[model samples]
Target: MVGTALGLSLVLLFLSVPVFLVFGLGSGLVAIFGLNLPWSTLIQVSFGAVTKHVLLAIPLFIFAGLIMLRAGVARRLVALAMAMVGHWPGGLGVAMVLTMGFFAAFCGSILAAITAVGSIMLPEMKKSGYPPAFSVVLAASAGLLEALIPPSNAAIIFSSLTNVPVSQTFSAGILPGLVLMVLLIVVVMIRGRAFSRNERAGWGARLVAVRRAVPSLLTPVIILGGIYAGLLTPSESAAVAVVWAAFVGFFIHRELTFEGVWSALKATAVTTTVIFSIIAMATFLAVVLTYTQAPQHLTAYLLQYGIGPITFLIMVGVICLVLGTFIEIVPVFYLTVPIFMGIALTMDVSMLHLYVVFTAFAGIGLLTPPVCVGIYTAASVANISADKAFPQVPLFVGVGVIYGVLMIFTPWLAEWLPSALH
Candidate 1:
């Protein structure tokens, strides 16, 4: 029954069926054959999935991201990053990485990060003589950082699915996120030298740019700082981010208008609806998997084959990497984390450690090919071919693998900050 469901799901996915439909089709098959379960349970599970309190973070975070993008925060951030790094070898590339990191901290969605930052930076990089392919690659690869930062919808969804503490999941992501950013910065420094033709500006101009961006930078501080300080939960932080972004983008910056707000709100509604639908469908499928004891059966088979914890971890990573290349991060989190959490617990892995491993692996999916949502987004914004942006996949994947290994071996990298806070 497990084999039948898995095979059918993969076939559906390959045939370009939407994820929710694929999940529903697979679950329906399992319900009819594997277990004489009532179909109403599927409806109940789908509805219950969105009723999760923690799941509130998803829409709020998405709204915050859309608001910020519509409000012109990305432009301010890019200007500040360029002012700071534009004189360095590969300064534009450095600016791209820096801006993406900043945006990720607040937005927490790769598509948002790529679209917002890419629209602003791609043109500037091109104007500065950066190769269009390099610009597209930088934007697409940096989008992966959105998954590793706090307030990330992926982290929220993963937490909801696995019943892991969302705060710890958020904290566990910090170091790994910074590490990935640093690795990307290094890559840009190496390849971006030829594009850094601007003269170094004096301290006065740099300071001015910093001052100009201070308000924009404060969005992340307000969002993450409020969460870390225990003054707010992720949902509250996301709401605060939306309010703050509105304040900064409208009255303070005078950039956002009524029409702008409406547009952002509409975009948020569409995105949230799609994400929720996917979550609901994935939940129904998870119910089927649980009812059939497929996870237990699979785990037992792996153990029977002498697969150790490390080998199992490697296999999980490989599977996520493959799936991620073709799927968006949130749905992947919804579908896999529940099944994998059971296996991880059976292996006695720490929940914190497992969260890190799963998230890092899932983050890889955002940059891989076939689906590569981030790459497609960046490519579209930069007016470059997705094929042109493909080379950066290996580079970003290398960074992701390094981060994943760090989380696997030095679980402390993910656990320490959360532990200290507790």
Candidate 2:
């Protein structure tokens, strides 16, 4: 039954069927034939996956992202970031990275960050003499911060699956996010030298930009600070983010309208549905695989073969990177987390650390070839093919790999903040 389900999923995936359906139908087949389960079981499992309180944060964060995008928040963020970094060699690239990091706090959705910031920054970068492909690639790679920063959907999902506190997961991501941010800045400084032509803004201009952006900049402060202050749960913080985004966009920024509000909600609904569907279907697959004791068998095999924790972790990172190129990170998490969780537990690895490291690696894969969603989204914003942005992927990916290695060996990189806060 396991072999049959795996075979069917591969064929459907190769044939270009939607990923949700491939997992759903393949697992449904296993439950029906192998377990002799009734159809209602599948329905129940699929529905139950999205019924969690933590999952509620996903849609709320997504809604906030759209609201900020339409509210001209990205423009203010770019201006603020430029005022701080735009005079250096590759300053626009630095500003792009910083802007994406700031936006990632509120958006949490990577592709949305790429689209919002890319639309605003790409044109400006082009006028500053930056290469079009390079600009797109930088934007896409920077967007990976969306998964690592606070209020991240990936962190929320990781917390849900592992039973860790969402706030701690959010905290766990801070160092890694900062590391990646600095690494990206260095890369931009080196590669962006040829096109670095922007003049430094005066202190007066910098202060003005900062003043204009203060309201938009309060987003992460509100969300993370509320969590740290014990005033709100992660989901509650997400709800507040939505309300704050709406208020800022509509009343303060004065760029959002009733129609714009409706549009953001509609788009959020569609994206939420797609993500929830994939999670539901992947849950069904997890259920079927558990019933077959597949994870148990694999865990025993690995243990018997004397696979050490370091070796196992490295292998898991490789699998995450490879699978992530072909699948969305959420589904990839569902598909592999079960099999690896037992191994992780048996080896005495911290589940929180494992999740953070693996999620970061998977995010890096999103900027890679064949199915680089971030690259494609940002490239489209600039009216270019993904291939044009392909050349810039290697350097960013190298930095990602190096960071992954550091996380693996340094463990504290993922554990310190959460522990310190505790």
Work out the TM-score per prediction: 0.94, 0.97
Highest TM-score, which number?
Answer: 2
Positional deviation of 302 in candidate 1, in angstroms? 3.4
Q: Per-residue lDDT tens digits of candidate 2, residues 1-422?
A: 77888789889988889999999899888888889988888888777778989889899989988998889999999999989898888999999999999998889678888888888889888888888988888888898788888878888887777788898889988888988899989999998788755788999999999998998999989989999999998889989999999999988989999898999989898999888888888877877887899878888999999999899889988988888888878888887887788889999998878987788788887788878888889889999888988987887788888878877787788889899888
Top-lDDT structure, candidate number: 2
RMSD of each: 1.8, 1.3
Q: Which stretches of candidate 1 lie over 4 Å from their true place?
A: 304-306
Q: How many clashing residue pairs appear in each of the predictions shown?
A: 1, 0
Ten residues in sequence with the least summed lDDT for candidate 1: 192-201
Question: What are the per-residue Cα lDDT tens digits for candidate 1 across 1-422?
Answer: 76777788889999999988887888677876678877788788888988888888777787777777877788888878878888888887888888888888778567878888888878878898888877786777777778777877767877787777788888878887888788888988888766655678788988888887788778878887887788998788888888998898887778888898898888888888888888888876787778778788887887789887777777777777777777877777766777777788888777777776777887777677788777778889988788976766687678778777766777777789889977
TM-score of 1: 0.94
Model 1 score (lDDT): 0.79
